[model samples]
Target: MHLPLDIDSVKGFLDPAEGRALHDAALAAAVRGPVLEIGAYCGKSAVYLGTACRTAGSVLYSVDHHRGSEENQPGWEYHDAELWDHAAGAMDTLPFLRATLRRAGLEETVIPIVGRSAAVARFWTTPLAMLFIDGGHTLEAALEDYRAWAPHVIRGGTLAIHDVFPDPADGGRPPFEVYTRALASDLFEEVLGVKSLRILKRL
Candidate 1:
């Protein structure tokens, strides 16, 4: 619960109550190993997970390409002009992430892996205690992230997915699809649901 960075000040869409849930999940899961999260936009979720990992004497590996996701790009509903890199003609949030970790004194506890989610997952061999998926909202990107990283979750570990909406009117469907896929695969079982956040335990 005590996060160094003010949750609202960080760039991202994680709900405060859901953030607390993430912290609790990360704290429990980190007992098995370090936590890994995809789509660390500006470290809002990272701050929550990272603080818990730090408290548990573990670490969090935050994965992100820094370039905006499909919804975070220009002209998208989630786009933020402040995160746009005019010179690069792209959205870059890496700086904001670094600043967040630093301000939270979590630089040592959270390792940032800057690269496409799939590219990094391809070579990742470590079994993670927790895997937080909040990457691209497109089904292709969402499925890719799930398939790439879910296998790395240790048995009984935690797997958190954001932006899932059962009702179509609530939000996008990709995240919900992945959540259902995981349940269908029988590899994970839902343990908690807060707002649009779903936390499952690996089987």
Candidate 2:
């Protein structure tokens, strides 16, 4: 069977270290049903998770508004600067992500959904085997994404988030604040990459 997602392009986007870590975790897990990836950006992370999904016989639902957050647009050197100009108007990132997934032969395994987390949550009732949240950076957005997705993660499933560290250049708030608050509730156990990146397993 053809592999889903382009390995080369994904490697080009993610840091070698972080990419390996995520790949390893995905490989180790027993992924079932559909995996959800919020905030696809340029489809870099999707390549990592999508590979695992293809191998494990699962689907990856990539969700993102793709309008480019103010923080993601400015100061973040990783993003395409031109996209922000378009995001400023009414452009969304779903199309670019779909194209990338198609190039990787992942169009079948990867489904791109355009909308906010709340709206998307309304349609999914099955428990997700993996949930990756790379949505907005603001406290409200981060919290909302977590609240909406956390319950959907099956017991022992993994929840991963990006932009967890404070970078004044990108934004004053780190997602840790939200993580810390959520962790206190005893719903998830921090598995790995807690400081900069966080991986939590449902308890």
> Which number leads on lDDT?
1
Clashing pairs in 2: none
For every candidate, C-alpha RMSD to the true structure in Å: 0.7, 3.5
Candidate 1 per-residue lDDT, tens place, 143-173, comes to 9999999999999999999999999999999
**What would the per-residue lDDT of candidate 2 be over residues 43-152, giving only the tens digit for each residue?**
87777777778788788888888776545555665556545444355435656677788788778877888788778887678788788877777778888888888889
Query: Candidate 1: worst 10 consecutive residues by lDDT?
Result: 1-10
Model 1: per-residue Cα lDDT at residue 2: 85
Query: Each model's TM-score, in the order given?
Result: 0.98, 0.83
User: Could you say which candidate leads in TM-score?
Assistant: 1
- Runs in model 1 deviating more than 4 A are none
In model 1, what is the error at residue 63, expressed in angstroms? 0.5
Per-candidate clash tally: 0, 0
